[model samples]
Target: MKICFAVFSFLFFSSTSVFAEESVGISVTATVEGHSYSSGGGGAPVPVPVVSYVSFSGYAYPAAKVYIESDSQNVASLSAGVDGLFSYEVYGITAGVHDFSIYAQDLNGNYSQSVSFFVDVPSSAITNVSNVFVPPTISVDKAEYGIKDEIKFSGYSMPNSSVYVVVNSTDGSLKSFSKEVKSDRNGYFEYAPIANVFNYGAYLVTARTLYGGVFSSFGSSMDFQIMGRTSLFASRPRCSIKSDLNRDCKVNILDFFVELRWYKKPLNKEAKKRFDFNDDGQVDLADFSIMAFYWSR
Candidate 1:
């Protein structure tokens, strides 16, 4: 009887070991509108009125319980299907970045490692698609300027509307500069610093139009550079389109007119160097193709 008991104990230990080895941990994968998440990726900046959806799907031990959370708030809890597949969706996320976490627990009470993702939501106050409000537009006099040099920043908005401007250094170290002014009778407004008063570096300027104390959710932004002694080595301002003649941050009919006016005209050395998108010694259809690629972008 003692020998029989010893044999039974050995068999029990071996079976327990086999059970532990067969129990695999869960695994998860997720996306926002079919795009996988990445740290600081910012996803695609979308206007606020559009609905954003996040979907989580993954494999777990068959019949396992899966729990998903957004910023630690439990958003979903469900059981994996017979094939070990589990899926869930969270909707109506508000403006700003949000964090999503998902994990699973098997029948054996083993918990899987949580998978996390980040999504960024841009501000948009428009609720009706048909009545979309067109925000004001802004522009800078030039792309690059010397430190302390006067730079004229201007834009168009609703007549008599208030415009708020915010300027910040791109290097991520300095405090932002801000000012408020009213649009003129013709819906035009301009702001120039009293003095350069800004550190020498790349800067981003954004402006929003305000009406009756409410401001546009997604304001317009532009980039410019403050040239320093070492600016030659610094990053240059990005030009989305070589044919943006008015520098209004777009290539549209205005640019087409500028190109038409200079079509086949004798090009100055600077104009040839800057406007010659094709590098074939002139601005022509070849350059127009490049501009068309970025139209309305």
Candidate 2:
């Protein structure tokens, strides 16, 4: 009986060893939609149209879990199919260089060596390469702001041309503020909106060139925020009640309109100082609550 038991154990150990040997390891290879940096692929930064999205595709071990990382942050993950293929799309990638890394891990927890590649999104200001005309560029002086502060929106365009500026909510649901400003001899222009033109929230500011009364496509936008008065002065009643964006001494639809114009976008330093109701550096629902509290008051 003992001899029979030893024979069974040996058979079991031999079968397990064969199964382990048959298991495949995880492997991954990836590339940007238009770039090729792989081995034997001439290392060149492929030029992609300056757009807001980028797609990545690659192969991994079948039935493996794949992870896509950007700037050391895991942006996305997916499961490899029977064909050992994976693809992912990243949205709102602004003009710049981005490094994306990918790796795979099999069900048995065996990980593949990470593969990485860089994608370049050229600036809209960089024209003349493909006969494609990119519009002018605009920028805010800072990222946040206070209630009664002046914001300097500046940019460059064709020399002595007319540039139109638009400040609106990032969500595209609010009334936008628009103005036409002229560039100088050097193609530089600046627009300083009236103090308190924006209310407690975030905003997207964009600029486009005007030729013979026709506006060109807007270039990339600048994001900024306006903070709530309560955030600026938590202990002072006089300042706490300063949510009156229209300065009519009351917060009403007019003020709400101001808030709507810039809601749900990023903020500048000065705007953030005013709109970050909770002083959290973000103009989120918490800050909106503060604005709602002063509604019609």
Candidate 3:
């Protein structure tokens, strides 16, 4: 009986040590659901799928179990095959960024090294998004323009983030373009609209931040318009009187005269814009007349 027990112990140790010198390693990956735009070939990054793989040096089977945990929850369990290979599948994940980890259990219940990876889940909730940003918000500190003129633009975004400004007409015609600007560490960016590209009309202005690996949420947008001087005069606000070039206690024909006086001289762009009330491309009689027509209000 003692001899039989000794032989059994030897056999058990030998089987467990079959691939002891071969070594084993594991890897994992995840697939997110509903995270891609049909227009784009690839889905945005999503929660990584929990996949575990065990590799052996030889044909010996893996004498171990694989385990996976996410957010501290034990989610996967599987036994390695004879060739020391294994895998796990995870599902029913939500949209957003999530972290995952993989682990291995030896025959002696010894836990192996743990590995981690990141995944980003694109939100399908926000539709019609042109692009996503890492630091997803941009602020346009100020935006204003003269009558029949395009708006001046400037803003801030995540540092190193690429910012784009697109202006589209109601008819889907893209006009008045500008190049992307890289933000500084302070998250500041500044850009202007292509002056001659836009005519007097309503437009959609979209500002975005771009990133790689994991896509950010879509950017924010606002509606803006360009109009001739007549429109500005008609809608002149009470506070704008301070900008009266003619000092008429309000902005009117006299301001047009003040601008006309400098027409032949080197033109002051701001003065010309302020007095060129009609925005007829040229600040002449048309602008003066438009200003006169609305001089009182």
Clashing pairs in 3: 29-49, 30-48, 30-49, 45-120, 46-120, 61-82, 148-227, 148-228, 229-277, 229-278
Who is ahead in TM-score, 2 or 3?
2
Which candidate number has the best lDDT? 1
Worst 10 residues of 3 by lDDT: 52-61
lDDT of each: 0.60, 0.59, 0.45
Better by lDDT, candidate 2 or 1 = 1
Tens digits of lDDT, candidate 2, 1-297: 999999998999899967643322222222223332334467665555433355556444455677776665677888766544566666655566766656556444533434444656543322111111124557676566777777888866545678888899766655898888987755567899743786767788887666434344565556677664323332212222345665664555676666665677788997776566676777677766866654432
- Which runs of model 2 end up more than 4 angstroms from their true locations? 1-131, 171-173, 212-214, 229-297
Cα lDDT tens digits, model 3, 78-157, are 66554334444454445566555444444433233233434453443221111111222332222334454544554444
The best candidate by TM-score is 1
Winner of 1 and 3 under lDDT: 1
| Cα-based lDDT at residue 39, candidate 1 | 42
Residue-pair clash count for candidate 2: 25
Q: Which regions of candidate 3 are displaced past 4 Å?
A: 1-144, 147-150, 175-178, 212-217, 230-297
Supply the TM-score for candidate 1: 0.37
Candidate 3: residue 10 Cα off by (Å): 64
Arranged by TM-score with the best first, the candidates are 1, 2, 3
